[model samples]
Target: MSKRIFVGYATKTGSTKETAEAIAKTLSGRGFGVDVKPFAQAGDLGAYDGFVLGAPVNGMAWHPDASAFVRANASTLAAKPTAYFLLSLAYGVGRASMKRAIPARLAPSSALAKPVATACFGGVIATEPPIVLRLLFGIKKGSPRDSRNWDDIHAFAEGLAAKLAPR
Candidate 1:
């Protein structure tokens, strides 16, 4: 039987969900049985052979639900081949500090259970966010942008097939 992979995502503005779908599609094409769902609805973890957790960076940290998922499923995740992927706007604007900061942010999940793989991808942000979101992100005004690199995202999924190869 093909390896069954579960992809659970936590999305704020929905970009992470899309990324999860892309990863699931690529992994499915690679012959693994993949299921993608939001963290709130992600079903039984014990049913899958491997897992991929996707989340967007928010306020310099992995989304809270992502962190909570790891915490909730800590033991189950430890026994499986688990991977992680992050979508963040932390790239391209040339913030060198993010290199160190992002990993620090990821600790909440990574510390709970070691992962077989990890990937960080560029993210998307709306130009005119709601006033609260704008204030939270320190956004004044600008054109919306999507810096997601599909090639890299697909390549990450391809690499995951190897990392999650059936035992």
Candidate 2:
């Protein structure tokens, strides 16, 4: 039977969704049957053999929907070969910048199921928000940058695929 992989993500302005799609594509290229869905639309995690849960980091916290999905399906996830990835500005610059943005608290835990691997990738910042939203939040014009490292993402997906390969 083909391994079933589900990539569920919560995105505000589409960055996280893009990352999830990319991951699904990579896994599909590696021969796994992959499903990429928005966290709100994802249903029945128990059907998949493996899962990749991801979200964009906002205000130093993960999106509530993404976190809730994992929490709600914690048991089913714990039983499978699961993995997690994050998208943030951290992965863009040097280690110091990455470190400051990606915190240990954000990493997947055994409580959420011992994922085969976890990753933090860089993300984008858009400039189309309303002025009030930007000013109230003290948001500045962040440079358009994609800190996503495709090589690392591919390697991680491949590694997970190998681990979940049929015995």
Candidate 3:
């Protein structure tokens, strides 16, 4: 039987969901049985052989659902091959800046279960921010943009598949 993997994600603007699906698709092509689902919809973790969890950084932290899922499933995660991916506006800030920013954002999850691999991907900004957020962040409607690197995402997924492959 093929190894079973689950890719769970939480997203506000949809970039993270796309990321999870891309990883699932890649892993499926590599011969794993992959399932992609929202964090809220994820059921028991024990049935999966490995996991790929992803979420967007809303402020300095991950979306609450993603963090909660990690905390709730830490035991199972620690016993298996687990990877994490984060979508953040910081990734758009340049490589050095992103390198400096990643640890802080990952701290919470790392404390729960040490991921076998981790990746940070650039985020897509809402074309029109809510009035309050726009005023707070000084972003004009349609000003910010999507900075996701598809190649980087694919490479990360490929690497994850390799790591999970049986020897």
Candidate 4:
């Protein structure tokens, strides 16, 4: 039987959900049974052989639900082959910037259990963000756009498939 994998995410403006879907699609293409869902709807971790959790950076941290999920399931995650991905504008700037910033952003999740694989990808700016965010990020209206790299996202998923393949 094919191994079953779950891809769960917490998205503020849907970017993380899209990333999780892409990861699930790639894993499915690799012959694994995969299911992608928002973190709240992911049900139980006990049903899957492996897992992937994704979240976008908000104030240099993961969405609360994603961190909560990791904390709640730390033991199960540590026992399985698990991966993590983050969506952040820092990635568009450069890897060095991302590397320097990731530890604090990932502290909540990593504190629970270390992921077998990790990836960082650029984020999207919604066409219309709340006024507070616009001022905070210096994003002008109409400048909202995506910077995610599909090729990199797919490559990360492929690597994850290889990692989760039966030994």
Clashes of each: 0, 0, 0, 0
lDDT of each: 0.82, 0.72, 0.81, 0.81
TM-score of each: 0.86, 0.80, 0.85, 0.84
Error of 2 at 108 (Å): 6.2
Query: Candidate 2's residue-wise lDDT over 69-162, tens digit each?
Result: 8788888887887777777654443346334656453554435767667777766765444555445433344534565778877777677777
Model 2 ranges with Cα > 4 A deviation: 94-103, 108-110, 128-144
lDDT of 3 by residue, 36-149 (tens): 999888887777889899998887688888889989889888788888889876565334544466557878887898888998887787655566655544444565578688
- Which one wins on lDDT? 1
Model 1 misses residue 158 by how many Å? 0.5
Where does model 1 exceed 4 Å of error? 92-94, 128-144
Clashing pairs in 2: none
For model 4, name the residue pairs that clash. Answer: none
Candidate RMSDs in order:
3.0, 3.9, 3.2, 3.1
Best by TM-score: 1
Candidate 1 residue 107 C-alpha distance from true site, Å: 1.9
Error of 3 at 114 (Å): 0.9
Off by over 4 Å in 4: 94-99, 128-144
